[model samples]
Each structure stands twice: as structure tokens, then as C-alpha cells.
Target: MKKPRLFNLFLAVNGLLLGLLIMLPILALLLASSPVEIMKLLVDPEVLTATWITLLSSFCALPLMFLLGLPSAYGLARCRGRLRRSLEVLLELPMVMPPVVAGLALLLAFGRRGLFGELFSNLGIRVTFTLGAVVLGIVFIVTPFFVRRCTVLFDGVDKKLEEAALILGATPWQAFLYVVLPVVKRGLFAELIMAVAQSVGLFGAIVMFAGNLPGRTQTLSLAIYSSFESDPQQAFALGTLLLLISLLLLAAVHMLAPRDRRL
Candidate 1:
């Protein structure tokens, strides 16, 4: 009894410390500006453009993630072997790799003078320092997050449900659509919220690959950095808006997510 009580007390202290460590800085940012000052920054055209660009990039990248990642995640979920582990780890590299390093890799592969520059040029496309490349970078970094989440979600789904659906004369696509997708709907939605938050906070990759060109590649994170460098007052205001937006997105996900028996 004494041992359990001591362990619980230790955990409580550590948890409180961790929570305070995380919240104090956010609290400081929130208290940095007056309401009127926050409103002015919230209304700034450049800031507004940045917000729009961030949303557009997230939208563009999310589809790509679904297109490319869903198939991979599905394959991973249904397979079991040595190759599966290798493949999954390879895909997870992006998550473990530093964003700055990932950005540099993009620069090497798609930069104006790098490996794929001529290939892109031949196709009448310039990916680096462009809006499209910003989208690409965002996708590259975030796709793994969604894929991993979905893979786990799919793994948790009972295998019997799929077999039952097929036995009912449903095609593979139909089974997936009607049975698997519906079962994992809550987890999928949660993954989306996580992906969106990650995309919103993207900074190093966008700055490196896209160069933070205003109205084109600048995102909310970039806007925050630039605003802080230019004017702390406005920066804090933007921070307030950012914090509020993040909370809203999280709340939406939490409220809308369907309850499920999580494994």
C-alpha cells in the first residue's frame, strides 16, 4: 500500500511539472497583448493572406496524403512479414527525420539547380520556391503521420468484419467503403485533425523549400515568425489568434469524432 501511494504521488508531481512547463509559455504569449492590438494584427492583410495560404496548402496536401498514404497504410495493415516492417519503417523515416533536414532533402531533389530541376523544367514546371512545392513539402512531412495513424486504426478493426462483408456479396471496394471505412471513421477524423494541426504549425520545411514569399508560400507559422521579427506587439496578437484557431480545430475534432472501442 505504501509503495503504491508513493508511486502515485511521484507521478502526480511529475505530471504537474510537465503541464506547467508546457502551459507557462503559452500563457505568456496570450497575455502579451491588449484586445485592440490583437484585433489589428488579426485584421492585417498580410496575416490574412498567410492564414489563407496555410489553409490552401493543408487542403492541397491532405488529398495527396489520402491518395498516396491510404493505399500504403491499407497494405501495411493487412500484411505480416519481414518486408512489412522494413517498408513501414521506410515510410516512417519522414516522421523521424528533422524537418530542416527534410527541407534540405527537398532542396536537393527539387531545387532550381538540383537533381530534378531539369526534369521539372522539361515538364514546364518549377517546384522549388513555388506554391506547388510548398504544398509538396507539407505533404511529404505530414503524410507519414496520417498513414501511421490510419495503419494503427485499420489494424485495430476486426478482421472478421471484412470477411463478413465479402461473404455478403460485397466487392472489395464496397466492403472497404461500407464496412472498414465506417468502422474506423472516428480514428480517421482524429488523424485528420492531427494532420491539420501539424500542417498549420509547419515552419522549417515551408521556409526552406518555399522561401516564405508573401501571398504565395507564407503560412501561419511563417507569418508568426516574420511578424515577431518586425513587431512584437503584432506578433503576440497573431499568436492569440493562432492559439484560438488551434483550439477550435481540436474542439471540432473532439466533438465530431464518433466513439469507438479503441484497442
Candidate 2:
């Protein structure tokens, strides 16, 4: 009994230390810039433009993520055996890969002399260093996160429910839309917010694929990076804003999550 109590105490202390380790830096970042300074930066034209571009890129990537990720996730959830395991590993590769490496991979695939680069160039389309590139970069980096969460959510759904809908004369698409989707709507919404939060904070991939050009390709993350070199105070303010947005999104995700699933 004494040993068990001592172990419990040890666990509690470690948990407290871990929590503080995570919280302290966030606290420092939030307190580094005053509310007035943050507000001032928020109203600055360059900051506003960067913020708009960040939001725009995130939203633009949403449709592509939905179109590509939703089907892929559903397929993954429905699959089995070695093929499913291989596909799952493929999906996870991007998440585990370094962001800089992912960015480099994208550049290699879409740059002027890349595999499909000539095809795009022949069609008079340029992918790199544009708003389109930013959207593409966000989609490439963030879609895996969306797909992985959605796969888990879909896996929890009862296959029998889908079968019942089919027996009621619903097509596969209809069953998915009208039956399976409603069951996991709340969790799906949470994943959407998570994806948006991630997209907003993406830095390396966007910077590498789409060069940081203020009022053009610059996003909040890029803005923070650029400001850090010229003005650390402005960078701190931007970081505070980004942190607040992330916290709010995470709060919403927590609220939407099932009680047992809430973090």
C-alpha cells in the first residue's frame, strides 16, 4: 500500500512538471507584447494583409481537402489487411516528415523543371511563387491531418448503419451523406477546426513553395518571421495573435469532442 501511494505521488508530480513545461513558454509569449501593441499591429496594413492571405489560403485549401481527403479517409476506414496498413503509413508520412523537407518535396514536384512542371508550363500555368502555390502548399501539408482524424472518426461509425441505409434503397453516396456523416458530424466539425488551425500556423512549406511576398504570398506565420528580423516587438505581437487563434480553435475542438475523447 505504501509503494502504490508513493507511485501515485510520483506520477502526479511528473504530470505537474510536464504541464508547466508546456504552459510556461505559451505564457511568456502571450505576455511578451502588451494588448495595446498587439492591437496596433493587428490594425497595421501589412499585418492585416498577411492575416487575410493566411485565412484565404486556409479556406481555399478546405474544398480540396474535403474532396480528396474525405474519400481517401473513407476508403482507408473501409479497407483491411496489408494494403490498408501500407496506405495508412503513406498517409502518415507527411505528418512525420519535417516541414522543411515536405516543402522541398513540393518544390521539386511543382517547380519549373519538375516532373509535371513542363506539362503545366505548356498549359500556361505557373504553380510556384503564387497564391495558388500557397493554397497548394497548405493542402499538401494539412490534408493528411484532416484525413487521419476523419479516418478515425469514420472507423468508430457502425458499418451496419451504412448497410441498413443501403437496404432502405439508398445508394452508397447517399448512405454516406445521409447516414454515416450525421453520426460523426460533431467530430468532423472539430477536425475541420483543427485543420484550419494547422493551416493558419504552417510556415516552412508555404514559405518554401510560395516565396514570402508581403501583400501577395505572405501569411501570418511568414509575417512573424519577416518581422522578427526587422522588429522583434512586432513579431511578438503577431505570435500572440496566432497563439490566441490557436487556443480558441482548440477550445472549440475540446467542446465538440466526445467526453471520453476530450483532451
Output the number of the lDDT-best candidate.
2
Q: Per-prediction count of colliding residue pairs?
A: 0, 0
Q: What is the TM-score of each candidate against the true structure?
A: 0.93, 0.95
RMSD of each: 2.1, 1.8
Residue by residue across 142-258, what tens digits does model 2's lDDT show? Answer: 999899989999999999999999999999999999999899999888898889889999999888889999999999999999999999989999999988888898999988876
Could you give candidate 1's per-residue lDDT for residues 141-221 as a string of tens digits? 999888888899899889999999999999999999999989888778778887887888888877888887888888888
Instruction: Provide the lDDT at 181 for model 2.
Output: 88
Question: What's the lDDT for all of these models?
Answer: 0.86, 0.92
Among residues 3 or more apart in sequence or in different chains, the pairs in candidate 2 whose N, CA or C atoms overlap within 3 Å are none
- The 10-residue segment of model 2 with minimum total lDDT is 254-263
